[model samples]
Target chain A: MKPLHISAYTTVSALGRGNAAMLEALRAGKSGLQPLHFPPAELKTYVGFVEGLEHEPLPEELAAFECRNNRLARLALRQDDFEQQVAALRERHGASRVAVLIGTSTSGILNTELAFRRRNEAGELPVEFDFVHSHQLSSLVDFVRRLLQLQGPGFTVSTACSSSAKVFADAWRLMAAGLCDAAVVGGVDSLCLTTLYGFNSLELVSAEPCRPADSQRNGISIGEAAGFAILEREPVEGSRGQLLGFGESSDAYHMSTPHPDGLGAVEAMQAALARAGLASSDIDYINLHGTATPSNDRSEDRAITTVFGTNTPCSSTKGWTGHTLGAAGITEAIIAMQCIEHGLMPASLNTRQLDPDFGSTILLEQRETTVNRVLSNSFGFGGSNCSLIFGGRNDHPLP
Target chain B: MTTLYLDNLGVVAPGLSDWPGAAKVLRGEADHLAEPLKLTAPELLPATERRRSSDSTRLALRAAEQALSLEAAQRLQPAAVFSSAYGDPTITHKLCELLSGTPPMASPTLFHNSVHNAPAGYWSIATANPMTTTSIAAGDESFATGLLYAAAQVVAEQRPVLLISYDLPYPKPLSEKCEVSAPFASALLLSHQASAQSIAQLSLSLDKGPETIMDLPLESLRRGNPAARALPLLAILASASGECLLPYLAEQRLHITVTPCR
Candidate 1:
């Protein structure tokens, strides 16, 4: 496997401010979900809302790109010590060698939609309105690159839930193929009436996000988040973190539902293990893309059963932060990496009764464990599945 | 690296919908695209499933059906990769509207289809292949990204892979960014083994050149017509050897080297 290094990473979900805050929330079994009150609608539901975000004004530089989603991205990128780390990378590897890849379903479109609605009613857009601020999907990635003052291969992946998860694969390929030396990979999705009402229209949103593997599980609670990770070729002997392998599979099964047999999920997990040159038992913790949806949990449970059997400790962080859609992949990947950093596996929240079909291997409560290799699973709507393996530097002894 | 052959092809575009129909147009047997090929969802998809899928999903599934119609059942399990530029913008726009409102509510159908991999998901279920699938989006470079992703999966997994790329014009207002007409989907069943009439080899690289390839119309190229891109490769292969340079991105370019089998 090509050597890939995660030099720096940052995440801002309902889990909290930085990686430390996220780890603490996971350990405490605290959830970031809260009932959101905004425009009057027929249906109201819980959301993984980030507190104190509405008050944070954008910096003068990013003022033009302001929107709920980009605002969250600005705050996430503002993590303590994050800029300094990124700056060092920029200095070391010229801006052109640093690539930017963002996974977002709605890239400030909500802002544009608001502006459009006003314009439609009044027959004109406001004089101060800047359509470029919210129009193209690439704007988010472009904005981030300019803000960071780095240039390389700038790309925006908008593949629904798997968008950001796939960014890791792209970054790995770019670095391995010598396209770029370093890359910033992450996703940003803000909670908006569109997602809320859209999910409500589909009837997939649960009144409450139920237990992931529990028999009584209902559906998922949507959330907004901004999660980013910096990947580069690993340096000599000692390095911050390493990306072992990322395995991807396409089910071509259904638009909305996963295959009943979980074939794609199994293939992805197996492929990741093969890429990492490790057996299933080698994984200490599994950060499941447990969106809490009945079909998703069931299919994923079957896949887990086929791979780890009844041993690996697995939990869904969606209970802490509602499914962040595209951000879920990276958000959960960051959490898995945190677990590897600190030797603890976070428990799944709201889980009381486990599904009889699900094996006992699924961890229901937070527990302490010796961590090394962590497997993170992300399955998107189109049966597009990816399983990423993350481990410490020493996990793979030098060749 | 193993050489991948284009064993079968499928497309559901603005004018062409089925394999025979699309092939006819590609072969210059037909003069125009049909009306059924232009049919929109709510009409094309079943009610039960229609409520769950986005327009992209519908278009992709239709294209997948056309691509797989002639292939055997055993070939269905090949690893799959789906690519798109804009993804489900219609649902995305609706989701945005719901979010800006007082009480947020999301449409389950739209949310389900909003996933970038929804088309891949639908194709897998519709075909019941029980294989691995990957969904990718890379802005304007999606075609190249999709090819790279498919090639990687084939090399890593050592299995045949299905590469599908689709893009639809966002409904009203949002359509400004895109120039293509009607929703379009194209599928290529790529395998390590060569078939009856082999397609040309794909070689990608970074090169400096004039920004545009004036030799071919952008519309025909964007429509996935072989004449503009695929036919050139076929012509090169038929001549025993040939090469053509295609504009990749602004900073990079792709030079395709083609050689026909004896």
Candidate 2:
């Protein structure tokens, strides 16, 4: 696999905007989960909802892409000077040479949720409710492409949770095939009623902040976030991260539940390591897809233990950002880069006790260590699974 | 952007149920229908899975089953890529109706099936294949995008790849706004190695030309559905002659050219 450098990255999550905020929260071992106040209420659960979304508005020219999902995407792009940086990239790569691939689960479905309530007596959707520009899954890619003024190949990936992580693989394939010289790969999923009530109905939402790997861990703390990464054929000056490899698989077990033994999860991890040409021992730390649910954590732990022998330091950042669903992939991948840059392993916050039934090393306290390669797992519903390997390049780029 | 072989094809559309039927329609042996086509459940999927399958899921799985069940596609678990422009609008409408009520009550069944990858999962489950499956959408350009992705995978991995592109009409509330009025799904089994049964060889490259859609007599039916955008490519595959260029990236307006094997 040709190593595609993650030249730049940004994330707007429950903690705050950009990578700095995520680092701050990680260092402080802060938990972002809070009681839910948004609509589609009555689910007594905690969520990692971003603040001030109501106060921010989309750029006037791009207002046609308005929705919670796009707003969050814009907010994320605004952070870490991502938009300006991409503008520079556009100048270098040429707009037509750059591609935009975005991943999203519920792309502006909240708008439809609201519009459904405003239906006329004849039960017709509102004329102003532009479904294609807003609620459609393609809207995220369309909005991002418009805002960035890109002309290269573009598409949207919507395979539940692993959607964004899989984008890294696509960018690799496209660039490797010389389809695009650079790509803007990322994901955005804003808080919406569908997930709020849907996960609740499935009895998968936890009432309190989730505790991954805890013996009594019950369910997940649903979260919303947006993240992006710039993948260039060459490494940018001072770039600390490169997409070394990625693996994707389908559990093929059930639609909603995970494989009891994490078979697909293991296969994905092994494939990522193989693609990266790294041994299992080469992994410095792992960002588990530990959504804090009993089934998810247990299954992920088994997979981790099988691959890394329960000695590799690993933790679930969901306690800090909650499970951001589609956004989890890039969000955590950025976190893995942070680990390589700062030499910090964020602990699995909120888990007071480890699940005795598991054998994986589930870190509970922040550890300051020399980090190199990091593996991040993101498994989605309907059996979509993706594992991404980032960082581990020892030599510094020309500065 | 690598040359690959199209080992086989499967497509379902109005007045067309299989490649033979589609070839006939393209050759004027059969008349293209104007009415929406009804989808049939795939017998390969178990009763329980099929019962839970929506029209979109059934349409997707049936096409793949048709292609993979053929002798040419010996490996049932070829890496799969599923594409849809309008994903399960029926399920989305149903969920909307439930959520629109005073107190929202979501059906767990519909919620699971609403994800764009639901159909992809059912394919793997029915075939007992746990390999990587990707579900993507490119609005009206899904067919071209899916083709590029599948071809790239075949070249990169040096293995046969299964590509399924499907789209179905939504209920009234969504249909009144969305352009799709008919349901369509098509499948292609591609590989780097040209087999004895190869239908045609395709060399894909980005075309910086105008977006070219297929010219079908059932204009309204073809234009309304996104999957029908593949008709021009399908017509060429069935013709066994000539070259074709189809629309791709929306803003780039890039086209993908497909040439038949001599």
Candidate 3:
């Protein structure tokens, strides 16, 4: 697979806006998770809630497409001059040649829940409720495309947790096939009652901040975030990083539970290495999906050991931002980019001690190390799994 | 532009049952009638899993079963692409109803089944396929986007691919906002090389202007359901060589030139 240059990228998570805030939080060993209060759910778990969304609504020109999910996307786009960079890409490659691919698990269903609450006596939804632009799964991509003024192919990928990570592969294939020369790929998932309660129903929501790979690890703290990146077939003067390869696979075992032996996870990791034409030792660090679930960390430990053998320094940023669900892919991908920019590998923030049964070397404190390549993992419901490998150009030669 | 070989097709809709039966109506050899859809769970799923599957999942699995049951495709493990404008509206409405309650009693089964890729997951489990599978949506242009991505996969990986586009009508209150009256699904097994069961060769390109329209009755079906937008191209495949445009992104249409191989 040919490498795609990441020209520009931005993220808005509980850690704050842009990569600087995230790096600062990582360096200070501070966690951004606070008590869950917004959306008014009945759950007692903590969450990665962003502040000031109510004060920042969509512009009047784009008022028709209004919702929490799109608002979060707009906030992230406003950061790092992402929209202007997209405009320059639109100008360089005619507007029709830049595709927009986004991911979202529940786009604006929060508004639909409100609509359901506001139903009339006759069971009729409110006349003002906009389902097409607000609640549809495609709304996230549509909103981004219209806001960025892109005109090429665009669609929404919704495979739960792996949604956003898979878009990088989609962008690569489209470019490889000559459909588009560049793409704007990212994901947006806002806090909603459905997801909040959905995780509770599955008993996967941790009552406290999640602790990855810890012996006492219980469950995940749900989070909301939006992250975007621009990928060009050719590199520009100051490209951020390179998407060397991505691998996608299905569990073929269970819908929600991963394969007991981590078969699918192993396949995804090896496939990514094969696609990148790199050996296992070439990777400098790994961003584990490490959602803090006992089953998740246990299974991922086995997979990592089978592939990298308990040697590569790895940690889960979920402790810092919690599990962003669909946004986890791009959120951690940007974090991996930051790891390359600054020679820093962060520790699993909430985990005080490593699990005795675990084989991998889980980081306990931040370490400053020379890094060139990073592998990020994102697994989701429906047995969907995707692993992405990103690297700088100094070590690996261009294909 | 890229060229792909369509090996087999599976279809399930209001009046159309399968590809063979629907071909006559699509070719104008028989009158199309509006009828309620009756779907059964695919036999491949375990009994318990089948009983727990949602209508959207069953609809997609049924179409994939029809397309892959052919001997030529039976042994080929192809990557899959699933698309739907509204995925499992029944499950969504159910979850919404549950979440609106005071305690919010969300069922675990319903929560996992609520994902857009639930159908893809079930299909992979039934077939035991470990290949890459993706679920996507693009408002009303879901089928076109699905087709484009499937073709791109064929060109990139040089392997057989299964593309499934399906949608079920939403329950009341929600239906009033996004009205899809009937259930519809279609599956296409595409590859870079023609096989013994190849039906047609399609060349896809982007174009501007109005898309191809259907007859009065089928036009309503096409307008009501996003997956039904593939009818124009399906009709061309059922008949002979022709070109038709399907709605794509906001300002562009997907122009497909079909060359019959049967």
Candidate 4:
């Protein structure tokens, strides 16, 4: 397998607008979670909602595709130096050699939902409700491609929470196979009624923000975010970050639950370590996919313990950023990259006391450490799981 | 490069329930297009667990069972790649409906099935395979994506992979979203070696030409009956000569150069 370079990246989450804001928030231990209030209902809960985005106006051409989810995507794409990074990549590699691969569980279905509401009320969908713009599974990827004028292979992966994490694998394959020189891989999932209500119905949404790994940990707090990373086949000196390895596995267990023994999760973590050619002790910190759901946290804790034991520091960023669903993988991946770059590990916020059942080492506060290698996990519904290993440019020797 | 062979193939589409039945229909030996069966949770699922499955889950399980027989089903472990275009639209629509309502409440079952990988999960549970699996969705190109992923997995992991691609007709609100109609499912058991007597080697390449292939109808090719496209390649391969270009989308062409070695 060939290595894929992380040329440049940017993210838009509840923490704020770009990489700088996110890094600053992580450093200051600022929580992006806040109470959310929406029309047609009243539910009191904390959400990692991106502020000021609700009123962000879309351009006339992109207005027809307006929805909560796509709005977040547009806002993320319009962030500081984000468009420039994409343009620079396009210039380095021809547009056709650059691909767009985004992961989003809800794509533009939020818009479709609104259109359906209107249809049900008026007995027909409005003419302006373009199905192509509303429900195409590739809508977000297509939107990004059109925005950046990319002609390469555009795709969207929707494998639940691991959606964005698997994008790294896809980009790696494309680059290794010489299909594309560079690719944009990440995810975007915004807070919509469907996701909130759905998780609530599953009894997985926490009344308050979550406390991952805490004995009293209840459920997850949903969030919205859009994060993108530009990946290349080869690295340029002093340019950006690098992706080490990614491992994926499926547990044929129950739909909503993980394997009781955490076998699949353990296999995926080990596979990632093997691909990166690193040992268990080589990982300095782990960003766990701790949704704070009882089963998920315990299962993940077991998997982490099996691999890293209780020596390495690990924490679930979901405490601060909330569970971004499809976006959680990439959003947290970006956070891990930041940790590697800055030599600091963000604490798992809102978790006062660790759960006795969780036997793995966990970082409770923002700690200064010489971070070299970090592993991030994203486990989704249906046992779709992915683990990504990230290290600094000089952390490992060139292959 | 090592060549991968298609050892065995099975399909449960709108017109057939089994491979031989499908072949018969393709050969014009059968007239009636098999009535599309709506996979009910009760009929296609484990008797005790039927109430827990969604429509898409039922369809996926039924199609997988029809694709993998009792003998082959026993051989399957968790390592499979499931692909679909629109995954569980019924659940997706229900979620959307909840989002539109006051104090939204999404069904737990619906939420579980909404994941694109739900089919893979169901198949793994049914087959008791604990191996690694990947689920992919690539619009109309889902089948090709599955084939590519399966081939890559076989080459990378050195394991025989089961590739299942399925999609059910979208419900009313979602039907307005995409232009697909009628439910269909297709499965292929691919291996690095020729495991059976009827093995076909598929070589795909991008070629420049005016779209349409000689003597091949564009309509039938677009209808997703790959056998129509496969027949020409089979004829050419059987004779040990010639190549067939199959149209993929409008701008792209899948130049399939087939060779038979038995």
Write the candidate numbers in order of decreasing lDDT: 3, 2, 4, 1
Question: What lDDT tens digits, residue by residue, belong to model 2 across residues B1-262?
Answer: 5688888788887777888878988877778765556676888777888778888889998888778883333354688999998789899999988888878778889899989999988887777787889999888888888888888778878878899999988888888778687788899988888777677888777656655555557556567788877877787777776566676775333343455554
Candidate 1, residue A286: Cα displacement in angstroms equals 2.0
Q: Model 4, stretches more than 4 Å misplaced?
A: A62-64, A120-122, A397-399, B1-3, B32-34, B40-46, B66-79, B193-198, B208-250
**Any idea what lDDT model 3 has?**
0.91
lDDT of 1 by residue, B1-262 (tens): 2245566666666555655665555445566443434435523244666656667777776666655652452445676777776666677666655554444555566667666666666665655665656565555566655665565555545567777777766554444434445566777676665657455454444456643332223245454421122333333333446665544434564455544444
Please give the range of 10 consecutive residues that has the lowest summed lDDT in model 2 chain A: A390-399
Q: What is candidate 2's TM-score for chain B alone?
A: 0.92
Best-to-worst TM-score order: 3, 2, 4, 1
Summarize candidate 3's per-residue lDDT along B1-262 as a digit string, tens digits. 8899999889999889899889999998988887898878986677878899999999998999889963333379899999999999999999989887876668899999999999999988888888889999998999999999999989988999999999889999788898997999999999999877788999999988899999989999999999999999989988878999999997689999999887
lDDT of 1 by residue, A1-399 (tens): 765787778899988888888988888888888776544434457788888877987788778777777788878888856677778889889887888888886677666656545545534545555545654566677678777887676667766777788788878766655567898898999876556666667666888754677788888888889988888886533355678887877665566677776877888899888877888888888889888878888888888889889778898888889989878888988987888888888887888888888773667767887788889988776667788999875567224
By summed lDDT, the worst window of 10 consecutive residues in model 3 chain A runs over A390-399
TM-score of the candidate numbered 1? 0.82
The alpha-carbon RMSD values of the candidates against the true structure, listed in the order shown, are 4.7, 2.2, 1.2, 3.4
In candidate 2, what are the lDDT values of residues A188-212, reduced to their tens digit? Answer: 9988888887887788888989989
Q: Evaluate candidate 1 and give its CAPRI docking class based on DockQ.
A: acceptable
Give the interface RMSD of each candidate.
4.3, 1.2, 0.8, 2.7
Arranged by DockQ, best first = 3, 2, 4, 1
Model 4 scores a TM of: 0.91
Q: Per-residue lDDT of A1-399 in model 3, one digit per residue for the tens?
A: 778899999999999987788889988998999999875587788999988899898999889889999999999999998888998898889988999999889999999988888888998988999999999999889899989989888999999999999999999989888899999999999999888989888999999999999999999999999999999988886789999879989998899999877889999999998888888898999999999999899999899999999899889999999899989999999999999988889998899888999999899989998889999999999889999999974445445
**lDDT, each prediction:** 0.69, 0.85, 0.91, 0.73
**Pick by TM-score: which candidate is best?**
3
